[model samples]
Target: MVVLSRRIRSEDWKPVGVSELEVNALQVVRSVDNRSVIAGPGAGKTELLAQRAAYLLQTGASPAPRRILAISFKRDAATNLAARVRQRCHRIHAERFDSMTFDAFAKGLIDRFGQALPERWRPRSDYEIMFPGDRDYREFLSRQIGVPPAHIGTYADIQAISVKTFERRHLVGTPLPLDGWLQPTPAQWAAGCYWQRFLHEGKKSFLSFSMIGRLAELLLRVNPMVQDALRLTYSHLFMDEFQDTTPIQYELVRTIFLGANTVTTAVGDNKQQIMRWAMAMDDPFSAFDGDFGATRTPLYNNYRSSPELVRIQHILAQALDVQAVAPVSKTVGTIAGASCAIWDFSTPGVEAAHLAAFVAAEIKAQALSPRDFVLLVRQKASEYATVLEPAFVAAGIPMRNEAGMVGAIMLQDLLVEAVSKLIVNVLRLAMATRAGRHWTTCQEALTALVGIAHDDEIAQAKFANELDAYVVTLKATYPNSPKSKVASRAIVEDILRFVGREKVVAAHPAYGQGGWLDEVLDSVAGHLLASSCNHTEWSSALDVYEGIHAVPLMTIHKSKGLEYHSVIFVGLDDGAWWSFANDQIEATAGFFVAFTRAKQRVVFTYCSHRGARTNIATLYQLLTNAGVKKVKIA
Candidate 1:
């Protein structure tokens, strides 16, 4: 018997759920040497990191009393990684694993060590965070740079979204342009003034996520004691999605963990580096290796797609990364039809109607859940919704645009998902004659949502009882038979009152519980009003929807790190991917990511009359070579 750790034997271990890529990578999981792992989509990067944490914690490899910090780029990714570690190890061991976004990690440092920063850079305790756009910077500059109100044009009227960053030199207090204070140009002057005013927001500093990263870096460099404390607290570190790491974020890691005798692992695929517009590093692997003296490893197995689909991926992968080899598929080809196909239409409305009718008819014939299919668009899911919504509505299929905004919150916000899913399932479970399997899953989700460890018997028991008591209250309050239909919007309000909106707000500080959360709650409840379904039909729209009965329509970027039974790509013409010619590699990479998000079959829909087909010429050639069938509907 091969012993992985103290209590984990070979047969007892599995990577992620339903992903049995085996424990073959156990050596890397248990390795002490710092490494940068590059793997394609569905290669099980999350599983590898989770298993590594499990191995280190279970075996005391991290030298006990010390913890492991894993930083991810997204909230869901971080929470999912933490949940996996909890599921794989004992409660005591699992509690040592800490996973959070890079922003959250940096924000925490500022919250704790702002007083240690130089007086000029220290933020007030009540500083508010804002996500500013480029327009905000331009508008702020228009006012401070002596641009006349008449000449300021549209910028004069622009409302600032945040305190924006200016040119690198001016923001750091360097006005080395051809001119002085206002600099060579008004823009440079605005940049310098913006930096000066960043800390002077009426006695309350305004900080952005990037600003937080910069401050965190400054704090560590000036105060080595803080670094020493962090090193003492966490002996091992993992950076997930390293390819998307920016220069300052990388520097933040280098200052604290480099040569501090900490084992650091960075895992990501350079090909999937999609945040270039936000200034993702040009070469993260090389940069990380240069700093950490780390070795490189790549996992070349595709566990999420069928063999035919893998071949289609190879067609696009070669165009994106010539040096990288294609991943062999672990999924067998079982779909009776062609693994890939394309549908051509003369107009967007025709295409949308055909797609909705096709999917709805297929569900009726095949007896499959609507959730089995996912719709992917290049960007702005709402643009496609105008045509898609009515078509789907006529077809009687429940589909929600996952990328749309609700007031100030994106529909995918963690707090929104937690609250929305909780209410939907709670209502369903309440009216049922018997408790279903969903209740157990829902309970676990509630536990994780409130930051409870999976193995904490006392806390779990207490929460479970509280949940039962809450349900009892709900039963008495809304007592009805199973057939009694309820309003989805009302359910949202009910959960808010039952849990006390304040408590929900206090639980997730990431999104806040104040006016912002209230706006989100109100907008979410209003959004549900878009659905005409009384109750049963509305369940699909409001549920967390991990399983059957809901079709998730989102952008290709949001669809990463996920898979579905089938995939539908809408708007595959030049207009949707307008910048394809400028950055063909990244464009191809986006298309690659989209196609790889399928388990059995994938479909693409393009409207010839909608836009020019020249941009996606390579994709067309690749699909044809992979034997993907094409059909036109006029």
Candidate 2:
């Protein structure tokens, strides 16, 4: 791939206000010693970013700076944008498009940071961070530390718990005695609280990748080499899904490129800022004026939807605080024959089942291709997999689960499994041979290994003694058991064998029978896991491609810049739907985003009970009052 002169003329680009806003944003970024962009939902932020990158690379006066670094919150978004840029450029610089998820970008930083750490402080693993989904460690911490389960739960729950714990010890004295007891100092209380948490659930392994964002910010701020190296290495910075960046990430961006002439543009829809769990928040609208000196623009003329569908969204926007700047109050989607349906599901399970049934019906009635529809769950919560999956399966709908690798054993999990297996092996060997001393040592290892291998440990003798004894046992049992072959290669092979490669592939959601699943999976997994050649290489799994039959479900954020023949808005007006402050903006913004997705028709469905009934009534009222002429509800 090589860079060439711009093939697309300046006149070829669309001039939506948002498009102009994006252009202006880039111009400011070009002038900024450093810059940040803030965009609201339906703002065409990503499109502007892609256009800006393509524009710069195509129009650069001289040697275009080394590379243009475009990052996304998701690997898919990054890869998609990279491809779009390649197409837009009319030529691709294979190395110039440094599009990667922030995590991937941070690992490069970690490589440098690891070397700077004191020898004693060297990290146990140099690999990517892993976050456990089960909250098992949190539960263990709660039990061990005498904190209620209600306190230390989810990531949010842990923060709340930490705050409560901090307050309980420092603000209130321990078990206020009937007779006056000596009150502890605030410092002493805080120290005791810290000790309690550390003694219980303070394992370093529990740190999530999000923490890397925090650490990376600190590194860039503190380390001149890191800051200089980044700014010097990359001259242009573009971010997609910019609204989803957390404060920590914002700090990281500031530290890396402060006072640099490098062009930096962040494009994202604030209404679509959905990753709150990871601390991602929509870039405040005011930030554009303050941080980047950006001018806001509206992309009101949606090219995706028809007039009727577009009008419907305008009415729904009243439910939220922000109004959608709809593109011309018209829908002109490609799928003009599509139909929308609204169904009332009284409960969560009912909603799940109704969605499943609706998808199944659509596949049959429309004779639609499986690949045409996608199911977009609200979050990556287990509720979808546990409850919704079963409903879909029970409905006899052959749906493709697009959820990423949940069933597969993560590397952290593998480490935990190996430790458990090692303890069992030691105990079993000692029990069979009746070696009391060996058994006792092995038991001590099992106890100590739990904390030592996983967390910092002051005692090294326990580890050394356990390793020496394990070697002795291996020597004694080499011929009888599969011992003495604990080399890295052999260990890997053994683990894979124990993991049952066949079983893993069989259990994979994507691997379950249709178009291109086998082919796509093979290509993706082959490229990603090329180092491992022990497994069979699959050429095609067309059977997997054939299974996609669900009514397409997707988040409104993903649906942006995309259109469907028919659109159904389910679970609308649920109090839970707009529980957060940002939720209101996203929901109203979603009304616009969702409406634009429909080609011919749109259906908004919610439960009859609760506020849903009132919600829909108000929607109808707004639509009729907004010159919709005739609004019908069935």
Candidate 3:
């Protein structure tokens, strides 16, 4: 009887092997009156989200407006989902849906409201990049917690600590020092105070990306005009990875298009609520249909992985407070004749070497290329000493990172950051006009000009003297450096090249491909600084990765949305996943996310020798229950 039902039952509606879950979602979404979508893991939530978006797009009036807004928690996921939506819809009436990450969308909103803010916080015509200040926030906190800097387990730990600390101290304007290396000046502290008050009471505050959802909610309630504008802009909103959304995000969703925009659909698994630190509250899966009162739908089919992989995931899900129930228990395809075994080398160099060897074996034995496999680690820092660096070098495999982009035109970011500093410093120095260019050599001049009354007088003077000597060396030996001109450009180039080759290892690719992207970015950067201009371009590390031809060794979190022929989940220990942080209950969601990434073979490696009672044992029990055969625990 409803207009939505009329659209759903149209003759053009042909099922494309949608699981019962998807069908249920389509039916329920049509009658959306604020109900919860309660489903288990591997329930085709993402599929449903895509389908819901496609259905809305296809059935809508011809020549789709950019009314449908879909958002993802991560940039990659957003891109992937958008691709899927574009593919599913018919071209004759293709949907022009707008997509972006929540942070990016929030940044757009902030830019729109920039003029209303204080003068200091006014929007800049140029890029306003989020810069990391002097001291690494996590390193500082590690000292306060009495945890050794080396003892910091993962980047996730660092990020969590940083986010929490930033919220407590910087965002909230609470000036309590954590560990004393990086102290905010009086002015900085005052800025923090102002921001805190602004967030608490001010209608429009300078919000960090983490706090965007909260701000969006505030605007919805406080600014009806913005809400109406949003309604006109986005007739319907479909949020993917709903489980990861924080409480304030949910409130914002409700506040904006509550009555006029009733066609709201959210997709997520209750078992995958992993971002508790960012204030992501209860699982939005059930709340989508229940608390928010949208129609409920269940999607239980597992399409991404083989049955064996699904079984492994289902087994792991048992450890969670909220577990997903598998609809049809099917095993994944066999990685036949492929040698799969798990081994551990405690030391870093040896571990890297071992990983490289394993990758080599996979390439030789299974006919897999380096790009076919990915080596994922917990942190970017881990890639160098522990895994990919040594392994790749030992096996003669090339690798890429920020440094790999060297001399490449793609990496403008690194170039901009590095060259800007150099030019600023050069301008202060006021070096000779090679091309009548003004240079600033502040560090050199300031060292001789002043002295800290309470500090080491002799040593300070000596340091200043040494700095002057270094400047003289630059002027005489490398005049074409940052301080000099076109003639000096050669010297600058040589210094950058030498520094990169010797100390930084070509922070990017050189003239050829797979060298380092950093080089290209820096080269473009220097040119931009000299030219004084801006442009928008983008690139990725796909070349270095594909060329290396190695197996991926990475963390479960990093492994999200990535699949491989064979996935070996290392470090399935309880302590690693449970962590000291309070997000243990939600963290189990990662196990499902990781296990499902394996397309064929799912090999889980556990360190049973290290601990008395291992979480892997529990995982084993779950796997067996889910009908995973040939699962050996070693």
Candidate topping lDDT? 1
Question: What would the TM-score be for candidate 2 when compared with the true structure?
Answer: 0.58
Rank the candidate models, highest lDDT first: 1, 3, 2
lDDT of 3: 0.49
| Model 2 C-alpha lDDT per residue in residues 1-634, reported as the tens digit of each score | 2334444444443322232443444453333333444443333455556556665555451134467888777755676676566555543342356777776566546545744533322333323244433253345334533432332234334334443234223312232222222353333333334333432333432224544454455556556787787777687887677767766566666668656756666666565554654556545445534665545544444444566555555555544434645445323444434334445556657766776676677667767654455454333424344656778778876443343331253221221232323423452433344455555445443443343432334454565565556546544543232212233224333333433445433323222222222343233332223222322211111122112233444455555545555565554554525443444454445555666455555655555442454433444455455544431233
Model 1 backbone overlap count: 0
lDDT of 1 by residue, 213-277 (tens): 87788889888999999999998999998888877788888889988888999998888877766
CA lDDT of every candidate:
0.72, 0.47, 0.49
Question: Could you estimate the TM-score for every candidate?
Answer: 0.84, 0.58, 0.61
lDDT at 341, model 3: 35
Error of 1 at 158 (Å): 19
Deviation (Å) of 244 in candidate 1 = 1.2
Over the stretch 287-370, how does candidate 3's per-residue lDDT look in tens digits?
Answer: 556655566566666666666556556556667753446555433565664223344434445545565676678677877765
